[model samples]
Target: MRICLVASNRFAIREPFAGGLESMTATLARGLAERGHEVTLFAGPGSQVHPEVRLSPLAVVEVSAAAMADRFAPGPEWVADHHAYLALMLSLARTGAEQFDVVHNNSLHHLPVSMAPALAVPVLTTLHTPPLPLLESALALSPDASRFVAVSEWTAAAWRHVVASDVVLNGLDLAAWSPGPGGGPAVWSGRLVAEKAPHLAIDACRAAGVPLVLAGPVQDVDYVEREVVPRLGGEVTYAGHLTGAALARLLQEASVAVVTPAWDEPYGLVAAEAMACGTPVAAFARGGLAQVVSPDSGVLVPPGDVAALAAAVVRAARLDRRAVRAHAEATCGADAMVEGYLARYAELGQRVDAA
Candidate 1:
């Protein structure tokens, strides 16, 4: 099958991935290509994908999330740039419709979903984030509304009122995230934003009497200064935006991975990655974390309860590392994700053929 993956233009679909969406897009593209399916990834300029997958740049130059933030307070540049990116993606999708059997939209923008009815081929929009006003409006205006998939059951439930979506759990490339010898410090990884609540992880790990390592792009600098910076040092240290081997190593070496999400996270990829690395997770029971973290692989506590999270860290540390890795291999491996998506694509193909 010839597949085209439409990625968000916010950042290149490369290492040191902007977030879960980009990582998932890259993984799916590579997995499909490895399966001998022809895959073309439509992403930002600096994207580096698998050799088997073709790359299609949506923008001439890569744009950083920080740059995007800078434009947000000044004027309409941010909005204009976003619209331009979306426009280009839609134009490419429309023009290249006949070249691919399926167009999987992971852009997380409303334009593709809004224009799905007019596309020559089927457009499968994977909702990676919760439904916002813009996305809800787009879905309401969409003529063909049956081509949406959600990353998790929790995410699907959030958008059930807007559009019926099937749940396809996100997966990680086991080869890249395979287990390593444990006995390292506790770890927390994700965008350093208020919503992710990395500071809470620091507090929990500290209370658990475990050293903590923080990793990932700092999405909110002000939050970092006010909440994260002051608390750094002693047992807590920031590893500064890690991906690929570095991130895998961090997860593998960790005694336990802490996930502190303030919002209803659509899916907790970090938790899955930690499990894949033979490390158990201590996550808040919010959104999809409960679904992703099986009892054998980790423990979930009430959200915002630092003391409970700390106790979970201690309990999770004693879990068998092999069990965590085994659970991840069985449930959240990339093969499962690719297979799930392939099934969806085939179903959509049958509908298109009948039409």
Candidate 2:
């Protein structure tokens, strides 16, 4: 089968990945290709090209200087990103059906969802985030334009009022995150931002009497400076942005993984990743983290409750690493995720042939 995957142009799909979305896109492209599907990925610059997966860079259009001169004009980057998606959608509208059996839209951008109906091939869009005004507006315009899949039951519920979505939890390569030597510091992984509340993780770690290592990109400089910077010292250490083996090794060495999200996370990919490494999770029971972290695998406290998180961390570390890994294998392994996607593609493939 010929498959085309549409990814975000804002960030390259290469490692150290910008986030879970990039990682998931790259993984699915390779997975489909390995399963004998002809996979073509439309990604941003510098995306890693696998042997089986073909890469097609998204066309980025430059906004005119005259357009920028308009006082009402939005930021240049926003206009540029909008243009890139518009160009991609227009291209797909022209030639997508002839080139592919189905189109998978993995971008958070509104254009793909809004313009999905124009393309001849079926579109399956995985909702990686909660409904935003822009995306909601797109959905309102063409709610039936694409099939929707949410990363968790929580995310699915978030969109239930807007549009029904199938729940498909994020999965990881468990083998790559194999159990490692533990009894080390606690681990906190993900984008270092206010929403993730790494600062709160620091406070929890301090109270838990556990040394903590924080990893991931500094997405919000102001948040980091105000909250994270002052907390960094004897109890907490910043490991900078890490990916692949470096991240896996760090998770494996940790006794527990701390996740303190101020917002309702759509899906706790980091918790799943940590559990895959046989590391128990100590996370706020918000959104999908509640679904991902089972009692046997980790401990969860109310969101922003540092005292509870601290206690939870100690209890989580006592959990058996093998059991934690077992829960991850049952719930968040790559095989299930890949198979779930393939099933959706197969349904869409049948729809295409019917058309």
Q: List the residue pairs that clash in candidate 2.
A: none
TM-score of 1: 0.93
> Across residues 314-335, which tens digit of lDDT does each residue of candidate 2 receive?
9999999999999999999877
TM-score of model 2 relative to the true fold?
A: 0.98
> For model 1, how does the per-residue alpha-carbon lDDT over 1-355 read when each residue is reduced to its tens digit?
9888888766789999989988999889988988899998877778888898888755443556686577445345456546655665567556857688888988866777777766777779898988888778888898364488899999999998878889899998898899978789999998999999999999998898999999999989999999999999999999999977899998888999999999998999999999999999999999988889999999999999999999999999999999999999988989889999999999999998898
Candidate 1: Cα lDDT at 147: 89
TM-score per candidate: 0.93, 0.98
Residue 162, model 2, lDDT: 92
Q: Residue 278: error of model 1 in Å? A: 0.9
Q: How many pairs of residues collide in model 2?
A: 0
CA lDDT of every candidate: 0.87, 0.88
Return the top candidate by lDDT. 2
The per-prediction CA RMSD against the true structure, in angstroms, equals 3.7, 1.1
